[model samples]
Target: MELIARATAVVGGTIAFLRRMGSPAHQAFGATPDIPAARKQGIMTLKMPAAEGWKDGRLPVCAPGLKVNAFASGLDHPRWIEVLPNGDVLVAESKEQAGPPKTLMDHAAQATMRRVKAIGTSANRVTLWRDADGDGTAEIREVFVENQNQPFGMALVGNRFYLGNTDGIRVFDYVPGATALAGSGEPLVAFKPHGHWTRSLIVSPDGSKIYAGVGSLSNIGDQGMEAEEGRAAIWELDVATHEARIFASGLRNAVGMAWEPVTQKLWTVVNERDGLGDETPPDYLTSVVDGGFYGWPYCYWGKTVDDRVPQDAAMVAKAITPDFALGGHTASLGLCWMPDGTLPGFGAGMVIGQHGSWNRSKLSGYKLIFVPFENGMPRGPARDILSGFLSEDEKLAYGRPVGVTLGPDRKSLLMADDVGDIIWRVTGAS
Candidate 1:
């Protein structure tokens, strides 16, 4: 065992050294010499193909094309968006500074929630925008909630709005005229604190359970997976009993989760383990099977062992490899399976938000992708749906799409650009 450990350590060290020396891992994933030269020659102007009917700075109309209108813009880091039944779009704007001081002895503790001198203010709040007037634009903008601590995912169920934050899940009464979230609602569930602190929440289709995507605090669970509560798993909580248990584990960072339309099966987009010189473990979008274990610290993408840790015997026995593997370091985010009989060609297709990458030397994934499906399974290659988020040179990206949803009209698509603070509506060609 010690020999195996030493050998793994040596391999890891060697990989790290090679990475520092500028290996192929530093280049864009699947980028060939011919591809870059062709791009330079204006062969492929952008990484992904432009959406159909998107010309003249006006979106094209679709088969059952609905009018595409902007609800809100000029938001600061708008993370998640939930559209209410009355056509009001609620946007969660996270701008949090470091919290108050924890102790005078350890005054230099620099954490967002920990007690540290506030370097600056964070905009942890929620905003609402509605097209009150028939102006085809969002004219009414109001602050719905304020003083939140890095809230991300939100789900609206009837008259209540469920919010998932770093601390726990909080419920707010959706008063039509309530300007702010000052009127306290009931606390649903308070999760045991763990790392990878972003806890994304979603309500089950039947509303019996609340599914929370809890990410591991560190890469490969170096913090000792046993010690961490709710890390690296999809946790399901009984909405009535408030009882929470692990639905699935070893998922590293399953940041995005949604339900398929026809199958009603739960699906997730995971940001897979990093390091390993970049290309070793590809991020994945897969259907989450209950009680399944996706090899995280032990293994990855099936058979590709992550050299960072010695294989745990028990975990190895329970590990179930991911169904589909996305490209390496793509930073897969919010996903929505297209409903059946919706768009003309996008029936039952999967739309995933690629939040772009920062770890790799060269950039990748700054647009939306469509993974077509047939008989409730992924069909062929995942095609780029909405391009132009990034430039051809790969130097800079204007917007990072985080959340995607079909508008109420079912024909138009609404994309939440977190960086650009804009919700873009793509209509069919005119």
Candidate 2:
């Protein structure tokens, strides 16, 4: 019976793929469409040769050339990271307090998102840091925004700063040389808030469209799809027109997204469905296509249907499987493509911040991974570029990386840790 079931699924997936071939959904889920073949090929040629100095363990102190620097300190629960024009870094501190420890039985039956609270503690705040004197250290740190209700993602376009929170989208004018929110501008798009309140924002490469990531409210089909207003999808809103629509759907939780420099394609790191044991479904990093469905409540990965829910055969037929799986429940977030001519070994590579996990019996993730790209596409496997955030014994972890971005220098990497409430900078060793 098992063999027959597997065979049926394969046959169904193949047929579905064939039927949807050349369709708009197919084109969106397909590989880099606009990139030139020659440049893409060149991007694939770059090799990440191992360096003798780049070891696996944590450094004694934050130092340059070690690819690790503590840029800011004393944060409550920093969740998202964004770099500004003057080289200042903005961090969103979720401020949600950790609940009491749970037993194995509680974890087995509890909902992952239920126990977690979106409301922040009194420490909830946004901070901005700038390194004065070019000493490679942030000497100035100021609180920019306060009393915010669970701010997650932030984007800066032209003179305005767009913020995505649990409530709705808010905008403020960028006050140059102003560190505090005293002179900050007013709010912009105040729409009806939806599920998975942590919405990440990004602008199109040309800055015409503003995209926001909305995660699913429930673990599976618990929050009925049709009943929920705006959940489990990416929404694209025109900056000039303020027009909004569902850009893509069926993604469990697309926490992070960024446009590729060479290919101009949007890629996302997803937090897949949970509660199906330890390894039932795997988190993924893939290209986001317009109107694409990525197997959420009904199906997963590509063809694996969720037996728990009433399967939608028509929707599953159009859902695209992810390009690459980043193992189960790694909590992948904040994906960015390393531009060409920026770093030597990581040209056109994808850097993902694994926020770690609380579901599995044994803890996993809690590090930064480099997914190499060949010809403007992800290569075979992802390699761990930064580890040691969690102890080997699994007893304790210092940080939970939520967001990652390239530094203003364009040669370094910056990661935001919500658990430790700090920002780490990574650069190549001299």
Residue-level lDDT tens digits of model 2 in 297-340: 88877767777778889988998978877765678887777766
Per-model C-alpha lDDT, please?
0.64, 0.66
| Candidate 1 lDDT, 1-430, residue by residue in tens | 2343344334434443444355343322221211111001111111211112123464312223334445567776676777777777777776334434444311222321121111234467778877677444677888888777677778766667778776778888776545556565567776654356556777899888888887876666665766555778888878778787899988888877888766888989888765553444667888888899988878766545555577777777677766666665677886876765655455567888887754443446776777787877777767766766665654345667777776656665667776566777655544
**Model 2 CA lDDT for position 206:** 85
TM-score per candidate: 0.77, 0.79
* Candidate 1 Cα outliers beyond 4 Å, as residue runs: 1-70, 95-121, 133-136, 176-182, 192-195
Please give the distance, in angstroms, between residue 283's alpha carbon in candidate 1 and its true position after superposition: 0.9
Instruction: Name the lDDT of candidate 2.
Output: 0.66
